[model samples]
Target: MVDDSLYILEKMRDLNLSVSTQAYNSILYNFRETDEMWDVYKAIESKNEHTYSTVVDGLCRQQKLEDAVSFLRDSEWKDTGPSVVSFNSIMSAYCKLGFVDTAKSFLCTVLKCGLVPSVHSHNILINGLCLAGSIGEALELAGDMSKHGVEPDTVTYNILAKGFHLLGMIKWVWEVIQQMLDKGLTPDVITYTILLCGHCQLGNIDKGLRLLKDMLSRGFELNSVIPCSVMLSGLCKTGRIEEAFSLFYRMKANGVRPDIVAYSIVIHGLCRLGELDLAIWLYDEMCSKRILPNSRTHGAMLLGLCRKGMLLEARALLNSLISTGCTLDIILYNIVIDGYAKSGCIEEALELFRGVIESGITPNVATFNSLIHGYCKTQNIAEARKVLDVIKLYKLVPSVVSYTTLMNAYANCGDTEKVDELRREMKANGISPTNFTYSVIIKGLCIGRKLEKYNQVLRDMASEGVTPDQITYNTVIQHLCRAKDLFRAFELFEEMKSRNLEPTPATYDILINGLCFYGYLKDAERFLCSLRERDVSLSKFAYTTVIKAHCVKGDPEMAVKLFLQVLDRGFDVSVRDYSAVINRLCRRELAKEAKFFFCLMLSRGVSPDLDICRVMIKSSDVLGWTIKAGLLP
Candidate 1:
């Protein structure tokens, strides 16, 4: 119908009737909705400023920015071309698209055209710069505004405050707020909200509450829930969930209804605090209120339930959502699949994966990755490989996680060749190995006793800018200690410390075991003492190593002392611990002392193993034979 009307209007114009600019604009507006701008341009008998402005503004709104610029530059209006309004339209479009640098460059064109940029023009460019993370450049532009006779308004200050907030420059945001107040420009709700969110993000919930109070005192009603939501989120983040819940109820009591966002915040807080029962209650309460849950709310509840090992309840919740005609997004599916996989319910996870495909929601790499992880956990490598093959069948690009999971599985099985092949394939697919990938490969090589490959892996990790984490360092150090390369192990340990990686208990265990095995009793004992001095919790393994070392060094008395110390320190003394002490005393021809330990072991309800009995019998003492014959206790 519009096309026919345009045709009739064009015919009327052909009959020497004057077609107004308003008629041209009307036709252009209709043409803009479709891709028939050329027809409208041809229908206009004489194009004027209104015709050009309407076309340019419509093009800008549609985000056909290049076409808008081309029309402004080379159209019939080019000679008597674009007004300030037309220029502002294009600049605002650029800013809206987050191309602040391009918008800034276009400001020069406005100056070259002798058109003074308006305050709105400055604000648009300033916002673009702020969003681009160029806060300094934004500030300079704001200063330039004053020079150009354009004073900053509340919008300008609000943009500056938000930019500074994003940069984590909370102090600078306060300065902007103060400047707004000094300029006699009252900070609006947006200004206050930005400040509130900033303080909340900085974990200054007290200051955020004060800001809330100030906003309320300034005649801004608690009509907007955003400020309350920000404060609630802040409280929850700082572990003040109780306070957040109080505020949530207060908002409702004050006649300010909580939205889905507000409800999600409180729900997440409850989940974090392990109050899942209350979280479920809140979910049911929201339903009773007819406030429908969104993806975020559902996801929070699903994750909370899954974390609590309530997989069955989580599945029921998902079913309820589906029954209510709510579409489940990929994220929700992935969360549930991962939850099932982690819970050792691989069959259920795979069934859900099939449901995803049947529902026409294409399973992503995460879905397959979860299945692969589940299979790997059960050591079903063949099934995991089938999932990897399915990834290619679906024509989906496997993520780094996909490759790393399979690589770790094969590495754990000591299939180094397969691990290498997967690493090559991952790189061929343009996926760089992350720290986790290198950690897995390095650990595999260590376990396979391919210690010579450590340097190459370390070099590759460095060249790829992937720093080895604590696990990687521990793996290397343990391998070195097992090989009896104590010096190298110590050097790596020192290097780990220098790099700020704290040594774990496993690290100390490996070192102590290696030290005792090599008969370095003195160094091993000193290291254990140093650990105690440093308040490091000594493991039972550490004490056992030192006890065995003392026995190896022909110090039966010292060995007994260490054994007694182990008991006094509350470390569970193993049978091997008792056997080591008894065997040492028997070897030293202290049959009476050995018998005393044997009787003590029996009295403590620890039945000695055959090794301990043989050691006592080999001493050829009648008491040992009598004890073995159950004639002595």
Candidate 2:
């Protein structure tokens, strides 16, 4: 269309017909960022203020800031300087490009040229300052607006209120509101929405409710939908799902229809709280109302399904959305592919990955990470390494997670050499090892029995300011305990406490078992008592370990006493725990005592294993005691 208009204008010029400056300005305004606009401007023999302003705006729209400034100061405007609109165009362009300082310098140029800055002139700079997190400077600029004889308007106060709101400065927001009221400026819906959002973000939900009531008393309907959506998000974030639903109904009861944002907020909240059934019900209700769900709505739903490991349903939903002409992003595909990969459906994950590439969506590091994790879970290290190579093919820098995952897989398979090579590659690529990466390295060193290298890695970890977390400590402690290095294990345990890393029951269990294995029965018992004192609830298996240790030390009486004590203390004994004691008693030549304990195991609904049965049968035959048939069963 623009080409046809320009061609007609050229023909008219050739025929000697007059072409007005306004016609040329119109043509210039419609032209895109092309050199043709410049050609047309140069053809205008006589230029007016509108002609200059049009070209200035066109240049700024094309992002040619230097050329636009040059044209403004051209000698043609010697009699009358450039207009404030032209300066605003340049300032807006500069601000949008994050050159706020340069944009502010132009304000002084506007005044030096004897042109009074308009309200818009200061508001643009104030907004830029606020966006740059320079709220202090923004307030100063607003204060100077009245001094410049440009009376601050409602839009100006609205911008100030929004700036404070965005920064979460809720307390200062009230001061801005008071200033607006003192200036006799009535707060509009936008101002109230900003205030409501501010209070909601600060977790002052009750205050936000009162503000809503105040809006109602002032005849303000909840038609904006943004304030209502803010309230829904606030309620959901605070885990008040029931109240969010009430507000959804209230919005409808008051004849204020909820938009897709409101519905999506509630749905996301429900999904987050593991209330997927209710989320689906609300989703269906929304669809019944013919309010098409947007990408956010679909994302929330897909995430909920993925969290519950419902990969099949999630993929079907994705296909349905695609069939409806929805242009899904890579994030949505990543969620589904990750869900399939983690669920051991690697083939499905790869198939979806191909679909993403075919659709021209670029795969990111997270997409490949999921595939690597999937192959690692299936013990397919060779294929997992191939996935890492594919990441480089996509021109994306592999992340720490990518390398650490594959490294851990190889380390678990006792291939420490491969783990070291990957670590070197990571360093060559400028990637730092996280705590998890160090943990994998420690495990590989333990598997290879390289004690000197293991000690050096720990020293390097500390020097690099990477504190050992619970997983790191547990890995080292387990390896030490296995090697009968209890002294070092205890030292690391105390270090974990000093670092505020609480030892889990698994950690205590490992220590207790280690002591028992080294014939330190009294020390194991002391530790067990300490656990009870600390109120750490160890599992029944921990108690069974102690009992088995006592029996192995040729103390059948002690084992029986400890078993009863654990049973009395409300720990459910397992088959192995009972077998440990009964077999020991029979080996001690106490056939009658072993049979009595067997009866007790049955009374407690614990079945004896085949080993215990064979021991009891052999003891009964040697003593000429007939075994009860029903008892054996």
lDDT (10s digit) by residue, model 1, range 457-573: 889988999988877887788778878899999999899989998888778988899898888888998998899889896678888778766765667676677777778887666
Model 2 is weakest, by summed lDDT over 10 consecutive residues, at 622-631
Deviation in Å, model 1, residue 404 alpha carbon: 1.3
Evaluate model 1: give its TM-score: 0.56
Candidate 2, residues 1-633, lDDT tens digits: the string is 888988999899999999897888888778736778878878887777777777788889998989999989874766556899899989988988999999999999999989999999998999888888889999999999889999888888888888888787878888898899999998998788888888888888888888877876677675657777888898899889999999889888877788888999999999878789999999999999998988889988998898888888999999998788756888889889888888888999999999999988898999999999989988888999998788988899999999999999988876888999999999999999999999999988877776578868879888989988998888889889999999999999999999899887788878888899888899998899888888887877667778878766767677777788788989757777777777877777777767777777878888777777788788876223323335433
Candidate 2 Cα errors over 4 Å, as ranges: 1-275, 278-293, 482-487, 503-633
lDDT of 2: 0.85
User: Which candidate number has the best lDDT?
Assistant: 2
Candidate 1 — which pairs collide?
A: none
TM-score, per-candidate, Cα-based: 0.56, 0.56
Q: What C-alpha RMSD separates each model from the true structure? A: 12.7, 11.3
